[model samples]
Target chain A: MAGFFAFLGDVGRALWGAWTFDTSMAQWFGSHPDALAISATVAVLAGASTLLGNSVVLFLNRVKGWRFALSLLLNGLGFVLLYLTQAVIVIAVGQLATGRTVAWETVVEAVMLATAPLVFGFFELVPYLGPGIAKLLQAWGVAALLVIVQVVYSTSWWQAVWITGIAWGVMQLVSWALAKPLAALGAWFWRLISGKPVLLRPQDVLSGHQFMPVEFDFQLEPGEAGR
Target chain B: MIVSLLALLVVVVLLFLAVGPLEALGWWRAEGADEAVTTLAEIRAAHESVPEPVPYSHYVVYLSGIGAIDGTSIPEEEQPLIEHLRGHLPGFAVLNDVFPYAPDNRGLTAARPMARMWSWIEKARFANPEALVAMLVNARNAIQLFVCADRRYGPTYNIGTAQAILHSLFRAGYQLGSDVPVTLVGWSGGGQIALGASWYLGRAGIPLTVVSLGGMLSDDYGIDELQHLWHFRGSNDGLEKLGGVLFAGRWPGAVGSPWSRGLKEGRISVYELGPMQHNVTRHYFDTKTFAPDGRSYLEVSAEAIEAVLLGTEPKVIPVEK
Candidate 1:
């Protein structure tokens, strides 16, 4: 009952905020006219970007399973790489200075911006290269694949490489975050569907043991030894 | 556990429904609207009283706040104050056009066919102006009466209703004369409108003199070119603190009292009135800063209008206490 009230309180606050938002905003805009349009636009874009990025992580987790850890590592590394890309130094000493200090969000943004073009190009150039390139020369097949993938997707060159690296990173890190939660949910759902007498516990499943273990009958052996 | 969770969710939803929507609606409705409408009707009636009207010395242009329409939503007690300005300000003309000077209300309605038509016209009035006497009265009404009742604060606290008001006045100026002066008397949110108008108009090579009462003018007013600015504060009012924030944030390097901060060197004037509440017209009039003793905001602002337009020192009359 207490938890239910807490949930109700949260909902009420959110709704009230939304409802009052317009009038309160209108009044604010009335005072600070110049900043209204720009601020609203920035806020909207930020929210949309965050939501889209989270969805992509969920989608990739379903496909790669445990390999999602690679996605997480790559995502983290991509951020670090982008941060390093900003400061080009003599003798490449800045590379050593770059560490985990770079935020994951910034890396995600870089990957999103960079990978957007590659995804667009793959669908566009693949069909044209398939038949036309085959007739031109079977020996140049490897070259043709490179041309379609690299030429169209790799337009900006360095930035594209950086972005693709980040995209690769996002895929891996998201897989890592989702892996444990997804597995737990999966077990819960399986127990619900199969009507098994087992508790929906991921730890027990991983350990290969029953949640409620039974005692062994070693008492009879002790009495026989005494006789 | 499942039942508890579900029950908890239901209760949470019910509480939200009970409070959230209602709070939103209450704040939205708190905007003091009828005052503008009442004031407009009174002006219309006052205009009817003139047997043979003279071409106004300047246009008494009033801008409404965010949520309500000016002239149309003014309260009854305040009607005479605006009417006196409409009837008395020498060379003043009353515009029949409802510029939808308020953006939210700038839409098609039975009474307002030209709701936002002023936006286009304001552009045309860049060079011409007979003169403009504007009242930044709407914002005060909305904030002090409407938003204040809800006790909610947000970014909206920073917005000013002056931009739209200025745009309309600029258009009106274009229709009148190129070298005309604009006198503004703004209260609360209307004060912001006045500040923005003066800033924009001053930059355009037109002269603007604004006298604000308990308004929200911050140094942020982009009025480096304004000829003159006057600021007034009711000592006891709560809005002074917030308005100062805008002044500090927007106008980083301004000097002088709050009123004179954006004015040219030696052009700014500051007036500190005795401690009073919002809508203290009587106190303002008795202080001899306003035209008629114990008059409404519209009448008092109009008196200041005559001062700016005629370019003379205001006459002082002792109130018979």
Candidate 2:
């Protein structure tokens, strides 16, 4: 119990320090590998927590047999994808964009450590304030990430933002390109494996709602004009 | 040095914000209308080899919606469509037309902001012109072949799509109810283009039956020119149903037009699938279709076309999932 409180206290302090952009936290992580590991692990856990429970439950239940395995594999793949994207690929992009060299370890460590604010996601269940707080914390985490990257990459504040911003744009482009194909592929795989295709919502048509707010004075459909 | 570099970056971002940097850079512009015409001409030229001695009783063309190539790269939506047609419609020679402009989806943003941005310009329905221009580059005209149907994603591009369809039939030695009756089936935006084909190609003296599967409606002049229009809509395809209602003149009102009037006059047949969707591929093709012989919407549609062409009831009974 005491150890748990100690861990919580340490996490709280680190998160507060990150929110404040305190350089001492960065210095401490640079000197103390164990603290860095522990905190980074916590951050990873926090990140993974978003996906962990549902995936674990689905896997254990053997939903569609191979489907469960695919889901679990995808969960792990998601982590690795984020890590490679942020830690390796985005950092490389940052280097190219900013003309500054940041050690791989620095990016990896800062990324994991910068996830401090995500630990507060538990408060997301709070009514009204919960979702708002969650979003604010996420935004705060982004700011914290920019600060950490600036400090560890040893780039000017603007340069850090630029690198991360450029990386973000790249991510957007990549996601735009791959989203449909990946979705189609995944849908295909699921159908092939489970023998059930993606279902269309009955509500989609039944909504009976027009996309436009104004009722057209003109008739678009055959019988709609009379109505 | 950093200050200048930073200034340059800001300028680039502002430029991007102004003209949809990706569009300005032509990242999404895979092929132009000319390429579509060239591809069609090539395929039409290729059809001369060992042609069927007797003319094909029917010439059927399939054009799929946004983000797909109609030919070999036909996406899941129309893969089953082609398969079913092949098995069922032995009298018809199935042809796929590749329309450029709307290419495959490969960008990072899942939102498909470009499609939305361009949609505003095509429809000329803009609540936020500034935002639309920023995303669509303020250039509303120009259709991407891979994109779904719209008022004018690229109005001229539809002409290319229409040209390819028309030439393919002409080269295949087929005509309207003489050499062979033509049936054009379009899925999603392809449906809109299919209607546009009737409007455009009909003007050029080519007439064909159009089969639309959850297709967006158009307000072009030639919508009334097509002899028969079969529209297969899924009950759950709310987004597509919204298309008719969203457009100003296309929606319900006086002076009944093609999209509105054809249904009233029996020129357009509406087949409302029991549990269908905006996508026949996802709901029917990916999974097995309701038809025992793998006949989903298109196979059933093939029957409908046969009835129109040969004076028989299509008996297109929807198998609700």
Candidate 3:
């Protein structure tokens, strides 16, 4: 339990360090032999936070039992994969923009560390104000990424901004291009795990068809009309 | 000390926020409609004893405000209002046994993990004159109300609430698919519960009308599904106005929202009750406070509700500025 708290403290410090563009954060990540493992842990925390925050999907779909557990695990894995994809995109963009080589591990570490803001993603569970909070967290994550990039890559703020912007744009384009296939893959995986076809649309969830048909005895006996 | 207090307040707020979603999600785990059967059975037995037959002309399900702790308990101040409503509205069976806070119609003091703690809170609330402990009850129920209005949790929570309501209606001898109108009279948070349940109730072919008494309602529910909504707000009820301000969907600018559409289509009506406060003394249900016409506030509110139920224009009582 103490180790867990210490790790939590480390995560918090790393996030704060990245946000302030502290050189020590970049040095800490570079010197650590378990940098990749630590980055993966951060990515997983972000993934889990997101799943818990927007768990309406699980509830709406009525996913339950071992299937629910599987969905959470798979979704978390999906988030980690997405983060890894972002890290790779950032590294590619950084290398091209700077014309200087940086360690791939360092770039991945920075990307994952930047996502530390999203650990508060559970705030998305809040009603009405949740979406606004989620948006603010996303903006914070982007800002953190810019700062982390500046610190890690030894780039000027403007260069970091350009790299982050290009990377984000590339990620968006890649996501848009692969959106259909990715969604299909997700649905297929969901079916394999849950043994049910996923209800993809919010309308489908709200359609009231998922509920059991309640049988009401509307038939009134004679002389029961106006009692 | 001030910083510590501020930190504690923040923690409390966050905890309050977390509790709603957690409770709503818990329903998914306990798939069975786990109602407080004892309470439902008692209510059902009471309804059975009524001399009236299978269907009354109308069924008014009264959802109490945040002060409600259980299905069986009605706040003392509001009891007279219910009695007044029953006395005036002939052919209407007023069912107030359904607890609006829990989606399963389970009361806080019902047999559950938190029952003991809730019971202690209830005791402390009454034992203490300050009644600060009562705020816990209000805050807890208020969170459930938000869950009912929330887009993510609303559908799940509302479905369960609708099911529980359907059970209560059946027990009350309400004929499903009957042309008889079912009016949900929700006070404060109860208003949102009524609106939430209307979606499923309407789908079941029940003609639904919602009567909100200083209700903190959101525009998330199926307003189009409601036959009509009569929202009564006391002039001094700033808390009631918070619904309109807090929910962006309630804003006039949200032209696509159900509430805006309901307003445009004349399915929703807002009425101003004369200078009544939202709660406690001099509230809508306060029997001691009388208008210039010599009718108590409870009488005036009940009469207003009766008018809406009867499809007549409610006479506005004159009040002192």
Candidate 4:
């Protein structure tokens, strides 16, 4: 009952805010009523789609013998935690010198850029080198990133925003770099742990396709190191 | 091991073929009929003007359903039934003559990418400007355009369907009267056509009522935004049981099932118009029942129109399976 009422209250507030938004409503309804209808319909449909999609997932969970309430509760709380984490990050950073707090975004950007090469280097390692060891190296790489950011101080809000934006852009490029190597590492780890030869290439694994190996030439002799 | 891997690869290929390209092929093969493009200005010049007003609370738009052949027009038999409905609407003007039995020009196929598909399909399907004028001979014939579709079923088509119909209607020079709301009346595949068009029309800024008889509206397209979306199906019609996920004998997803959870959170109303096979007029006209099996399109449409006029939110009525 309380949740229902709270939902109603939030809906009422949102509706009130939308209605009272003086600038666009009059112009939109008067000049382009069809656009207004279309926009409202799109928003409503989008929201409904989200709800329907989630419900389907929940139905699958039920088939797996999980309680529906548990799924709902976990999803609901997960969203709350995500919002809280973002809020804390923003508020804590906001307290820093306005431009200084912007460093967090910078840090994220840098981490994204460096991630790919580091993962690739980790994948190049022999089977004995576990991902845990690689992860430690990644942590070190991120720490080194902070020092790099501190050296090039952001002077203004616009500069910080630009830096953040650039870092984000770099992050995307880094993700592409890391993707193949990470798959290699995963394949190696799976083979080592499962006691089987990893035959599939990283690309095949990602594309959800089967990998077929061709014949390999081998020259075998005892004590080959001497030869 | 080799055979197993080969089999696995084959199955994967088959899955892609069945779920992906084949669906696209259906849309491609079901290309919009090469109908001439008709506009409102043309319909207006030819339309028979109405001198007096009658007491109709809403106007119904009927789109022609799909034809397996490309250049087929609305069958001659279906014409009289359409004419009868218009004739009965008291002061209602029949808009069908303005939109004669023309081919759909919308370029629709299943496999096309989503963003560009709808716009292209609508453009391809809308009637030519010449056709519009010949159809709208007078105001008595100008109540609203009616149309339908064949072969295609499901909620996703709702967007393209809506785009084409609304595009045609507006292009026909018919402005929805502020005093009289628009309603959609469709049969069989026409049901899906009406539902799809109404969905987009509502989105594209038309406030209207949609009542589909034996239409294929899967739960995937959220019908909650409709002023009223009544699905009238017969117990024997075998359409109501369809959930829109089956393609070449496979489920697209759990959510595609109409009975799937959370699929019915909006104003979509479902009623079993039993013992009737896709006939809305014959079933409901004389007796107010949609068919002898006892379904009522008029009653459902009326309730929906009442809600719209009163600006009241419809109460969700859960159908007992």
Candidate 5:
């Protein structure tokens, strides 16, 4: 239990570092022997938080039993892959723009730490304001990532912004290119787990039972007729 | 120490906020399905002796505020107002046995894990004179109100609530697609619940009108489906004002929102009652407090509602900024 609390403390500090744009924490993580392990934990925490945050969709779709468990696992895997892709793009763009040979481990660490604000991702479950909260968290993560890039790559604010912007554009193109194949793969996996094709639209997921007004058959009991 | 305390407070608040969505989704899935269905069936069964298609031209469903524990638990102070409305409106059937907090109309003490706690709180509410216990009751129901207004959870919650209302109306001999206008009189948090359920109710073909009495409502799309909305607020009611402050769609700058459209198209009307508080000590239903015109506050409110229902326009007093 003590060890678990310690682990939580470490994660919290890493997140706080990202929030405050503290350069020393980034530098320490970049060179620490256990940097990879620490980064992996942060990524896993992020993925878990994101999965919990998005569980509403699965609940809304009424995914049940093994399908529900499998959907969560699949979502977690998707989050990891998305983080890896973003990290790799940032590294590529940072090196090209700054002419600096930054370590991939350092870039990955920065990226994972940047997503620490998403620890509050479950807040997306909040009514009326949930979507707005999600957007605010995303913007916070992006800003953290920008600051991390500047510190890690030893670049000016303009250079970091340019690199981040370019990386984002490249990430979008890659996503667009891989969208079809990724979707097919996801569908195939969903079929294997749930024995059905994936529901692609919100309405399709919501197409189950709806509450309709029932006409009451008001027949009286024998003793209650005169009352 | 204060920082830690503040952090803890935030976590508590976040946890509290999370419960509303979770409870709503639970209801949508399987939490109260059997109970809701059984309750509806029982309501119909109870009304078995009433003549089929009982002759009432219009129906008024009164949704009570956050302080309610069950359909029958209309606060003693507010009972006279319900009685007044019924007495004044000749051809209208007024029903108040619908609890706005739960989609299934289940009371807080109704067969749940936390039923004992809520039951205790309710007992304490009457036993103790302190307002704290009552606030707890309000807090719990207020979360449900937020769930009803929430985009992600609102549809499911509203659908369930609409089902409850529809069944209640059915038991009242409301014919489906009968074009008999159903007026929803929602007090406080019940106002938002009324608006949220209006969409599904409208789709079911009941001509709908909503009267929000000091209701803290949202800028819901249900405004588009309403025949008209008459929102009443007391001059001293800051809680009701919070609706306009909190909902971006209610702002004048949000021209594209349904509420803005409703305002522009004249489907919604806002009226001010003089110096009425939201609810509690000196609220809308407080009969002991007399206005300058030698009438009780309850009478004034009931008269305004009566005017709206009778299609006789009441004096329009602009709300003070």
Candidate 6:
């Protein structure tokens, strides 16, 4: 009973962290209800795609490289578009830091296994610490990645940590370099489809607008402004 | 020893060809349900819909029995009855050909074989549909059925059958409870599936009607979820009674078969056929006793369903052996 309660407490604290984990992620997710709905749909499709992709790899043993590529492409569907873009960059950076020419499968498998602990990301649904728990899980995930790296590469602990840390740094820098243009592109497309200028001055919207109107001429519903 | 084993493999292959795939594989568990696809299957329209010749509005999604249901061509044995029923009810009917132990689209068989070749061969059409091969070559009449190619009959996976049916119905444009109402019709073990699907649909508060024709009923909470249940059982159907006797469901009290209580409560209608026997619909002549009578349980049950769909007074069959 005590052990059970301890486990519960651990989960509770972890969830508390997740609730407060990443406010920016939450803000980004919450800012657009339409995007959130689309993400949920993508999550379901991603799950289906992963199952199909993995099943194909496991069952159909012939032409492995093509099958592996197909599996990766299928998994990318679940990447939540830009939602997981940062996560990939982070993992890629960790991989580079390891400085080992490990098989892609080994790294992919290790990363996949390490992320199992983040199943606690379920806590991300909790109001208070959802984001914190998620963010903490990312750190936990990194530590796990380091252990995997050390084992797979047969390296010293310090080397593993250094590899992971530098790799993450590299990834973060690269993602930072790329995120702006992608976000701008996504935002521009969003405005085009929604017919609403977002994050753009009216004159700039007009000047650059090959597609969308350069006007924010509508009033927000009183109850809808906060959302 | 190698030559003997090679000969044995040949014999096994020949046996599979003779008895059909289900018995050959003894395998019921399969992956890849094609969860989203509802194949439309074959449909029996009462008359011409383009000229508005008939006032056909309702849909009955047909779930086949055990190993009998397959992904290949729709069984033609069912055509005579559906044709007869469509004329009266103008009720459009489609076969839900989701097989649990049938062959897959890839032509790959299950890795395991649950039934012995001799045992399966002797009964012919007793359990699974015997006309599987003959039915395979039967021409499709442009109607669609949501096919779940890898569905096997055990309870562990039957829910997938139900879920697939639910999605198929939704895709077919039948609103949950209203507008175009839905009725689930299952034969033999398929009855359990209809009831199980009813449970899921009921929990969602969707109005449903489940019609089980000699379906193997289990004690489940879904029975209470259905708006109405029409059970057609022959007195000679030993398997239908097997659920109650083996599982201890049909007891004197309401512990086993909810039929007694549900019958009294007026939510369930039981049609007890005396001369009729199990497997009499598709395999009518396969059994010695019911085959001589030359009556198709498919026709009888279809009429009973027609009554339910038409909202007319139901004709009652007395319980007799």
Using lDDT as the measure, the top candidate is 5
Return whichever of 2 and 3 wins on lDDT.
3
RMSD of 4: 28.0
How big an interface RMSD has model 6? 22.6
Give residue B320's error in model 3 in angstroms: 8.5
* TM-score-sorted candidate list, best first: 5, 3, 2, 6, 1, 4
Query: Which of the two candidates, 4 or 5, achieves a greater TM-score against the reference?
Result: 5
Per-residue lDDT tens digits for candidate 2, residues A66-154, read 66556657755665476457666557866786787777776777777766766555443221123355577667767887888888777
Candidate 2 — which residues are off by over 4 angstroms? A1-227, B1-54, B100-155, B175-179, B254-256, B280-282, B289-311, B316-321
Of 3 and 6, the candidate ranking higher by TM-score: 3
True lDDT of residue B217, candidate 5: 84
Chain B only, TM-score of each candidate: 0.50, 0.61, 0.89, 0.47, 0.90, 0.59
Clashing residue pairs in candidate 3 (N, C-alpha, C atoms within 3 angstroms): none
Give the runs in model 3 whose Cα sits over 4 Å from its true position.
Answer: A1-8, A18-38, A200-227, B1-12, B32-55, B128-130, B317-321
C-alpha displacement of B263 in model 1, angstroms? Answer: 4.0
Please give the CA lDDT of all the candidate structures. Answer: 0.37, 0.53, 0.76, 0.37, 0.77, 0.46
Task: Give the per-residue lDDT digits (tens) of candidate 5, residues B24-95.
Answer: 677756654444456445544544534355579999999998888888775566678799989989999999
* Cα lDDT for residue A42, candidate 4: 28
- Candidate 1 lDDT over A1-81, as tens digits, reads 996675445433322322222223323322343332333332233233323222222221121343334434444454334
TM-scores, in order shown?
Answer: 0.38, 0.40, 0.86, 0.34, 0.87, 0.39
Say which candidate scores most in DockQ. 3
For model 2, state the Cα shift of residue B17 in Å. 12
C-alpha positional error of residue A132 in candidate 3 after TM-score superposition, expressed in Å: 2.7
Interface RMSD of 4: 29.7
Candidate 3 lDDT over B202-305, as tens digits, reads 76567789999999989955576898999998888888999999988898899988899899999999988788889856788877888888888788788888
**Model 6 lDDT at residue B205:** 34
**DockQ for all candidate structures vs. native:** 0.01, 0.01, 0.27, 0.01, 0.26, 0.01
Model 2 quality (TM-score): 0.40
Candidate 6, residues B1-321, lDDT tens digits: the string is: 897699668545433332242221222213322221221111101011112222226667776654342432234455554556656754464545444232232111224243343233324444555545323221110001101111111221333445566556655554432434567877665576677556445443345788877766654445666778887777778878775663333455654344555666688877674446665343322322322345345555566667777787655344443
In Å, residue B107's CA in model 1 sits off its true spot by 6.3
